[model samples]
Target: MNKKILGLVVSPGEAEKKVNTLIDMIPCALKEVSQNTEEWQVQTIVDSLTGSAESINEIFQKINAHTKKNAWDVTIGITDLPIFHEGKVVNADINEKNDVILISLPSLGWKLKKNVIKQLIIKMALTISESDNDSNNKRSPSFINIFPRNYKSVRLKIKETDSFHTRFILGSKIKGYMRILTGMTFINNPLNMLQTLSGVLAIGFTTGAFCMAFTTMWQLSYLFNGWRLLLASVSSILGMLAWITVSHNLWEVPSKKNRKKFRKLYNLTTLSTLMSSILIFYFILFLLFLLLSVTLLPPSFLGQTLGIKEGIGFTRYLDMHGLLLL
Candidate 1:
């Protein structure tokens, strides 16, 4: 018997872009799945069918009836509306006997990356067809035991969830690359790009302020003792920590108290990245200054500007504090 897969887009005209993407990617995905079975003939048709259904079960039933009437062996329905199961957001849901799979596009996040969404849809397709057995076997036996008998029904929550890590190796380099590509693509959208630019500017401003404080302390060291510079450095770091903590709390979800730990981790990572970036920026600036000074400035001019004493050598002056300016 020939296998037929029907892809449907149950969304309004506003979501036609997503529908177009699904139409283009689903065939390639099914082809990948059917590599071992040459007898299977896969064909796809896409159309806009907006439904007023709210719950996953209702949406599934609606799609099931439609698929049955159309004589589609397997139906994959994509919708812009949010879907929920057990009071939690779900990316996709499936019914085995009904041979129908419903994908809730909104659950994939607001910043849509075509490749990520396509992969997710493909994953759902494979899951529904039971062709994900090889991948499933890689997971822990305890996890595999939780699936319903014969994989009759499955629900997935793709965004802002810890479940994906449990099912797949979360640290894969390929996965990292995919995420980076997705982020790059997502930022192509005007709103997402603006948000990214805002984040960069925020980080840049904070790092610049911290670097300026360090530079100020370094200048003060020329007049005062080194201990004063050390104290200032400690204070600057404390201020950065305070700012991170405050900003994190302000942006965090108030209802998720457990996120406090994750927020700390995020803050620590951000702090390290910020400090390292500032240090690198300072080093680049110092290099440029030194190059210009060596190529353009006269020795006497350098000596005077660098505060070289009558007997102190230019090299010695550079060694003492010039490199420290970086």
Candidate 2:
């Protein structure tokens, strides 16, 4: 019996995480998926493949080169970058001849990508094993993947079988857009970015303290209802997102190299990532202020300023002061 080696080349961050977690299960999975008697050995490596926006052909070639260099029977390249073909997002690219597969992590969305990847890997193995379609080999969608929002929006039904490769494309435009956006946001990891920026944290804390110290600030918080405060919070977040977008020039302008749709998608991704970070920051600030308002400030002092005669619980105090202070 011949032994086959499988190499996984994954994008550096979250893409790597998704694939690495499968290292133990994949070889055993391939054994079960493959009808052949060969034992499978799986190895993993990290690579970004290419930084270019248009990297489909480049990725395919890189997968081949990596396989040759590493001497593996099959190579699967997982990238966080969105793969676009014919104005649509591509979920997977499989070259049966070369025994190579390229998976777009962002197309697989955030939560259920790990399981989806496992299923795809098994299916791709089955595809590579067959020269023609077998009706009995039809794979059903996992129950976990039925929900588009919670799982992936990438449906594996559309297969473009060709001399070179088979493509799995995302079905709906709206679902594809959202899946790519959320996946991109997940890969970019804005909350981690927020944690590293000391200046932002310092400014946020200082401003929060300044607002909390003022009696007038508390009165203003008292005057504004929850709806008004929520509006203000949303407005401030939007303003910050806009400012960051313009100031950093994160918006992708169309060029000879990149298409208008890609630029639009990328710009939306940048905003989404930034908005996630800012919203997380806002929530953390609210929680922190809520904790402080209950512990540090006296209920009697708050009621006197708000002109409330009777007993109001800490929830009301938190609702009025905590987020408004931020």
Q: Among these predicted structures, which one has the highest TM-score? A: 2
Which stretches of model 2 miss by more than 4 angstroms?
51-55, 130-162, 197-199, 313-316, 322-326
The clash count for each model shown is 0, 0
Query: Pick by lDDT: which candidate is best?
Result: 2
CA-lDDT, candidates in order: 0.46, 0.71
Model 1 residue 57 CA deviation (Å) reads 4.3
lDDT of 1 by residue, 197-241 (tens): 455445544553354334343333345555654565556545654
What is the TM-score of each predicted model, taking all chains together?
0.38, 0.82
